[model samples]
Target: MELQIGKYTARISVLPPIHPKFRITPEPAAPNSTDGEEEQIEAEPISGFTCIIGYTSGGGEVSERLITCRSLRAHGTGLTIGAICHAAKGFRAFRVDRISAVSDPHTGEVIGDGSYFSRFAVKSSDKARAPSGGWGLTPSRMRTLVAGLNVLSFIARCDGYWHALEDEPLANFIERLWMRKDWEGQPPVAAILDHAKRLAPDSSIFFASLETIFGSRSSTRLLISSVRELIEADGIIQDQETNWVLAMQQHQEEYYARKGLLGSI
Candidate 1:
């Protein structure tokens, strides 16, 4: 068959499934309104491997099986090595007519397989850093980084600063934090601070401190609300000061228990 690509008309050919004697041609061009430019296409031919070409079924009608850049763990080619369109089944299908060019890397042989779908190596460059949930930096370091973030830096990252950390007072406080030295090389600090300021431009030191530990003032408010609810439900007699005293006593008891020291609850 002959098909036209751009301004150039090239011959296209396919081998018979029975006694395959393939004689390929450049696909001829058809009239197009876009622009006039000759399309360059070529294919590579491998010596030992079997190669064949044919038409592709137009889109969705074909099977989902594709020779993706994945594993070769499958035994033999479920669908022969080189096939076209729906026939590509599990075969490595390369577009012969659309191929720009082909060249053998090892021998530098200018083969005719570039247009044909051939297998190649694939690689990834993404780094898998440690996961960041469940726990965070120690309280002191967290505070230091939060204090070191600001609005300009936040705006630079161009993420939703306002929605992530909603507190005007806290935002303002974090903007001032950008001057601290401990946040060097810390992109998260800048991103979080920028997000906070965008959310709450007028935020303050106290709210900033709260946000550093609990994420946002709203979260801290929710925590305080839950604690108040617990206090009301339990009918606690102790105030904040007394609660602190009791908490300290509980810590002392835990410390003693860890050291083989026993006491009542």
Candidate 2:
């Protein structure tokens, strides 16, 4: 996690813990006594904070509610939560097992875990897809274009990986991109693309014409090659007959907007 939360940068670390004990059914010949059934069995002691592996809704957990879980945010009870993993709407993260002993800062009471998702990086302006005019690809098409193109990245020594933001959709990518205003101070689209390609070596950037951008290119062959590769396994490529210039402008504007660059469009 490269994001900064409050004063701390996001970090992942291993937390040492003990294995939990599972109850084995007693044999029928044993004298049955209900008195010992509710006894609590202690597990191994765990170290510091770490993500506890367990099933929750859509890979996350509900908030303010406990469901007799075997794990507790990978931490022992009585510790205040530092953060949560895969939880929908709870504190950054919390330990359910600690609920019995711990109290919420606001409520000052022990409460069941329930969903209370808060804190996200981006916001959406509209859910609908933009119209297809000029270079404007539908949200679906934009998604395809963004998904197929592998942006270049350096991962130190071992043949760097392109940071294409794979886990997020195009809209989300736009949200993050727009949030950073990365393209604001750049010289030109062509210059950036050229630098990215030259530096990364394995990168590929695609677009239709040189006229759309202010850069000078001796040939459109490279652009054509990149486009061909982008569309190779997908299927046939459809060309828009409308004014390519105007369409591309609209496409650029919409792309910027999707990314959250609210000014230009």
Candidate 3:
């Protein structure tokens, strides 16, 4: 299966029920069960399996990856898989719902139904510990931060030249305002900023994503305040940047008003 996300395209393949490295163990039956009665059985935890997937990131970039999934955990209304991502060369948390497609790594067959992973559910505690620098953020919150950063990148590029002065404040702002202290090292801020430049010409997609991901009044307020600070960081506020921020604020206000939350933010 082929999926499009933002400007990237990925071909997804499906995994077969049985692979040489994959195994499933049935749950033991309950004690004192009647012989004629049907018994419910659950599959044991999924330890590890290699598969190919088209994953859409929080920043709206999509990439195909070969991953060895180590565990599954309940996340909000969906599931999160902890995996060793070959492309990233690190353990990462991937929300199951954001997996555009999954396929067999060897054969490249498409898993049209996407139901294979849903059958093996596990508690959040079962997930493997991520390596250092993992932000330990939920997928939704990560999306919000990424989208907000993209907007900041847009503002930095509004004057057609990115000022060197903006970089430090941008980095400091992200660490101080958004990240948790325990999250050991910095996020991929440089990569996100560079990627945002490529998408800056038409950044409405990010704004739309941000609107959809907005969770609370405080988050919205923080984003707007951050944008304002970024706009003044280089000692120059372009007309374009100011106008864009205003439009964003107006859109957010209307959004909350429509949801009967105008008074909250």
Relative to the unseen true structure, what is the C-alpha lDDT of residue 165 in candidate 1, on a scale of 0 to 100? Answer: 26
Most accurate candidate by lDDT: 3
Q: Write the per-residue lDDT of candidate 3 for residues 25-80, one digit (tens) a residue.
A: 33343464322211111112232345667778899977776665545767888888
TM-score of each: 0.16, 0.16, 0.44
1 or 3, greater by TM-score: 3
Q: Is candidate 2 or candidate 3 better by TM-score?
A: 3
List the candidate 1 regions with Cα displacement exceeding 4 Å. Answer: 1-137, 147-180, 198-265
Candidate that would win on TM-score: 3
TM-score, candidate number 2: 0.16
User: What's the distance in Å from true for residue 4, model 1?
Assistant: 85
Give the least accurate 10-residue stretch of model 3, judged by summed lDDT: 35-44
Which TM-score value belongs to model 3?
0.44
Global lDDT of model 2: 0.25
Q: Ranking under lDDT, best-scoring first?
A: 3, 1, 2
Estimate, for each residue in 1-265, the C-alpha lDDT of model 2 and write its tens digit: 1222222112211112212331122223224422231122111011111222222333464223211111122234233233322122112334333232322222233322321111110113424454322123333332222222212111110122222331223223333332332322322334223222222111111121122221212112233333233322224322321122233335445545665654221
